[model samples]
Target: MHAWAMGAAVLSVIASGAKAEEVVLSPSSAWVLDYGDHRCRMTRAFGEGPTRTAFMLEQTQPSDTFSWTVAGPLVDRFGKGKVQVQFAPAFDGFEIDHDASLRVAEFGTAVASVTHEAPPPTLISRTAKPRLRSEPDALSDGTARAARLRLLNPEHGRSIARLTLTKGGESVSLSFGSLEAPFKAMNACMDDLLVSWGMDPAELREATTAARWINSVPLVGKIQEFYPAKALEEGAEADYRLRVVVGANGRVSRCHMILLSRGSDFAQRVCDIMRREARFEPGRNAAGEPKPAFFSTKISYRVY
Candidate 1:
């Protein structure tokens, strides 16, 4: 079946509003749905000429968080370590901070789960320990091409798109169909599930805040030194957004690239450099007292 068709089937099932403890199966498609126990989940498998890739999203009760799972033949061969998943349009990518554990299912499919949670500070620091590497190895075997899927959370309108998995320097993209229907269906299922649990759906709304940089840190020198040589040769120019948490002492405690115009490696370099070199004066709360704050900024890069 076509990938987009599979995605549409999955979304249709989700939008059907399955009741508690009921399973919904799409006709002639690899999509399945189960709603119960204060959670709703949808699973879809996309097969392409002997290669099958399965993706699942499960959202628990009373929390705005969800766990995403991807399983396939390629994942079966991955080594245990950090795996980077970069979503398309170039902005949505994240690293699976914890090691992936292989799950052997009925047909010997390998599955890995990445939960949406911040890695421990020590663990983040450890993995982020600077290493002097030139350019990232290019994917020569055409393993990086696959169908992309995006899972949208209805409550907060926040979505995560699964792109390609990079583990131990080898990367492979999972195949999926059109994500629009699936995402919408997932959102509908979530809304129904939330109502079934006797909770206000409004509780899932995302909150916003305004925090300004009290002092700016100069990053041009570091960017110039660490900018990728290949990017320079290609005259690649891009913009990146870094989300950082500043402590009361005016030092950045945690940071990550929330948006990027280039590849994941470049985003990592920007964050690493900023984390080590950037400093700020503490931001004040509404009452004028020093407080830890969240800050974000757009950094633009040009070869010239």
Candidate 2:
């Protein structure tokens, strides 16, 4: 696809939302993650208390050099967490293991750590499943052309290539195939290598489906019950995440807390109320059908 088309695809993935309870407020700043930068928002809720927090970083290089920025409520200790990051050059995934060091300064004390594990390996074959049909890598004139580059790892049984899909003006990249075939065996394999990089169609579908449910489901109107808590008070807030079921009838069928911030009373209270009151618009399938889907939400307690 053209550069604009690719930018649009990336933009679509960034715009996602989950309903927030009375105690939780959405971030005014857009959560932007570039190839090098990363951010995470965590929340916690208990009884009638709720709190939300955010962690931010701007990475200069995938291998090294990054600036860390943290905001939201203060906490006593950090907890277990996992993070995934995408690498560039449009390869299937990142080649080097990314180890992160977190430094926290609180209450006149500074604490840093490199205990978290490195970013996981992104094996291309792990995502390949049912492959797509291949035809001549043609341009608008409908002529076959030579392939420029190919990604092949016989050891892992995965390969893809870049071919001139269209003529010079409208050329695009397409990704296909999981198993390793002679690069020449596939007519447009070279073209695939040139344009499109390694991608996991199945993983893309699964992640997108789950993300759609979270974004489309409406959790604003059904708030059956609600109350405010002090855990969200400037210096005393927290962050948290929750897994919820958006029923076909546009209501939250069930919800469970996923992550909780230490001493975050505000997060807990907001979560309880959300579980009781959140509503969904329900989701439709390709046939214009409505179906129950899984969704998730994150909340943070921040000072005004």
Candidate 3:
């Protein structure tokens, strides 16, 4: 959900430093629901390499509204300045006079928060005497303010297809999936959050008779090395999610793509790899009998 997690996955692959005869680019379109620390969020990420980015829509209990975050290298390019946001269908743009600061240490991400109406004075006085100004401006240096923007804005309407961010002569555009699925996931997460809050013991127990992994393989290196050359030439990066079913024999019974970044040979190649190369230990029941189990994971490929 967070850029840090995605970056860590990429870094792990890079650290392995493996080489393959061919490269494979993974597909994108995976949704993950996360709940923790009195919060719930529905998230999805896209792109690879420097373009890696993630969108997270979150809500806290007792609050009917939602807050969203767009993090990754794409947002960092805007720097700290005023940018214009244009939504499709109407193409109407809104001027956002906000601060954009980069967090290089935390996955090279940035936050864009709208400036507040009344900002507090700086901790330290610049001059020998405290100079008072006629009008005080909003502080636009932190993420505190930007976190207030509603994810579902009335003006923007539903079914937003694309978003364009422009700062002076530089601009970038991003495509979004249909809003229906994400909103549905968000509502489900909200329900879970409320249930957790009202639990009698205040501690939820884990589901019983769950599947456990005995032997797992790391596929990041193999994926990176096998990235598709056509995708590399086109500078395309994709995020893919696959549902893998393992039978009692400790072999992948079937693998299917739940999400595809874009229809291409690359996606087909990755799916083939998962079906042929992926292996997993069988899951066991409470009686210790081997049973079939299903597992899901997201894979991403980027060319630098």
The best candidate in terms of TM-score: 1
On lDDT, the stronger of 2 and 3 is 3
Q: Write the per-residue lDDT of candidate 2 for residues 139-167, one digit (tens) a residue.
A: 11211111111123343334323111121
Could you give the C-alpha RMSD of every candidate to the true structure, in order shown? Answer: 16.4, 22.6, 21.7
Model 3 spans with C-alpha error above 4 angstroms: 1-29, 62-65, 90-92, 102-106, 113-158, 199-304
Off by over 4 Å in 2: 1-234, 260-263
Tens digits of per-residue lDDT, candidate 3, 245-287, equal 5566756666655332343355566567656676654454445
Clashes of each: 1, 37, 11
Q: What's the distance in Å from true for residue 47, model 1?
A: 2.5
lDDT of each: 0.46, 0.28, 0.45
TM accuracy, model 3: 0.40
After the best TM-score superposition of candidate 1, give how far the Cα of residue 38 lies from its true spot, in angstroms: 2.7
Candidate 1: residue 118 lDDT (0-100): 30
Q: Give candidate 3's error at residue 190 in angstroms.
A: 1.1
